[model samples]
Target: MPISSPRPPPLLMNLSLRSADRVSYCADMASKLAMDKRLDDFVMILESNGSDLSVLVGLLDARMVSAGICGLICEGRVGEVVRVFRLVEGLGIGAFELCDELVKAVLGLELRRLVEEGELGEVEVEVEVRRVRERLKRQVVRSVEHGGVEPTAGFIRR
Candidate 1:
C-alpha cells in the first residue's frame, strides 16, 4: 500500500477552540484579581459580600471582544496600537478601560507576526487594514447618529 499523509485539523476548529480557551482563562484570572483587591473594601462598605463567578466570566468575555476590536482598529500595527491606546486613555471609553491591557497584548503579538513574515505591506493585509478602517468609520458615524459618542482617540476637539 502507498503511504499517505494524515489530515490536519480544520482551521476553523483550531481557531474556535483556541479563542474560547483564551477568553475563559483571561476572564477567570481578571475576576480573581479584581476580587482580591476589592474583597476587603467591599466588606467594609457593606456591599455584596461574595464575588459572582458568572459576572466575572461575562466581564472576561467582554474583555475578549474589546481586545479583538482594538486589534482591528490598529490594523495589527504596534506603534499604531500604542497611539490608539493613548488616544483611548484620553477618550476615557468605559469599554477601553476593561480591555486596554488585553488589547495591547493581542496587538503586540499580531504586530510581531507581521514583522516576522516580512509581509506588512502585502496587498492582502492592506485589504484587511482597509476593511477595519471602514468598520471603524461606520461605527463612529453610527455612534454620532445615535447621540452616543464612544470615547476614542481623536474624538475630542484638540
Candidate 2:
C-alpha cells in the first residue's frame, strides 16, 4: 500500500480594508459575523493555522475601535488570541522599531536625491546631513530607551 500525504490546510482570506474607516466598519461587521454558529468553526480553523493570534490584536491596535469587535468575533474565545499575542508581541515591537528605521531611510534617500539633482549646494548638503545626523541620534536614543533595545555596537559605530 502507498503512503498517503496529509492534505494541505485551507487558505484564509485576508480582510481587505480600502481606508482606515473601512477597518472600523469591517470590525463591526466582524462582530455581527461572530454571532453566527459558524464563528466557532472559523475559530477552530484559525487555531489550526498556527498563526500568532497576537496578529489579530495588532490588527485591533492598528484599527483601535476594531479590538472589541475582534474579541466579539472570536465569540469571547480568547485563549488562542492570548497565545498568539505572546508569540507576536516581540515581532510587533521589532516592526514598530523598524518604522523609525524606515523614516531614516526615506530621509537619507531624499538627501541623496537632492544632491543628485543639484538642488542643494555642497555646503547646504553638509549642513543638512549634519542636522539629519543629530536628529537621528536623538531619535535613536529615544527609541532605544522606549523600546528597551540596547544600542548595538554597529549602531553606535554609525
Candidate 3:
C-alpha cells in the first residue's frame, strides 16, 4: 500500500469561526439592488442567461458573465449562481474581489441606463458618475497599496 500524508485542518473550519458575523454576500448585494432602481437593466440582462453560459459569454462581452452573476446575487437567488470563483481561483480572481467588481459593474451599467433614459440629467449624471468612478478607483488603489486585498484577475480581457 502507498503511504498517505495527513491533511491539515480545513480552511472552512476557520471560516466557521466567523460564521455569526458572516453576512451572505448575496443578501448584502440584494439590499443594494433594492435601493438602486436603475439596476433593473442589469437584472434583465442577467435574467436572460440560459443553460449554456459559455455560449452566452462568447456572444456578449465576457464582463456580461460577471454582470449576470451580480444580477442573480442581487435578486437573492444565490442558489442559481454558478460558483465560477472556485474554478478561477489561483488563476487569480480572489473570490471577494470578483463579487466587488461585479457589483460595481452592475451599478455602472445602471447609472448609464438611467442617463440614457433621461431619469438623470445627462450632463449632471455624466459628471457625478465620473466623480464617483474616480473615487472608487482611488479607493481600490489604496486597498492595493495597503495590501488589504489582492487585486483580482482571471478575467478574459476584451
Each candidate's lDDT (Cα)? 0.49, 0.42, 0.46
Error of 1 at 131 (Å): 8.9
Best by lDDT: 1
TM-score between candidate 1 and the true structure: 0.25
Tens digits of per-residue lDDT for model 1 on 40-154? 2212222221243333335454444454455454554444434434433433334345454766566666766876898655634665676688788988888877878754745
| Candidate number with greatest TM-score | 1
Question: Which tens-of-lDDT digit does each residue in 1-158 have in candidate 3?
Answer: 99999765864433454422223322233334433432343233333333432232233333434555666656644323322333334234343443447666555666566567875465455556756887878887888899886666332568
**Model 3 whole-model lDDT (C-alpha atoms):** 0.46
RMSD of each: 17.1, 19.9, 16.3
Candidate 2 lowest-lDDT run of ten: 93-102
Candidate 3 off by > 4 Å:
1-120, 153-158
- Tens digit per residue, CA lDDT, model 2, 21-86: 444444334334433423343234324334333433233323322343243323433333233333
Q: Superposing every Cα of model 2 onto the true structure, what RMSD results?
A: 19.9
Question: Would you list the clashing residue pairs of candidate 1?
Answer: none
Candidate 2: residue pairs that collide: 53-84, 54-84, 54-85
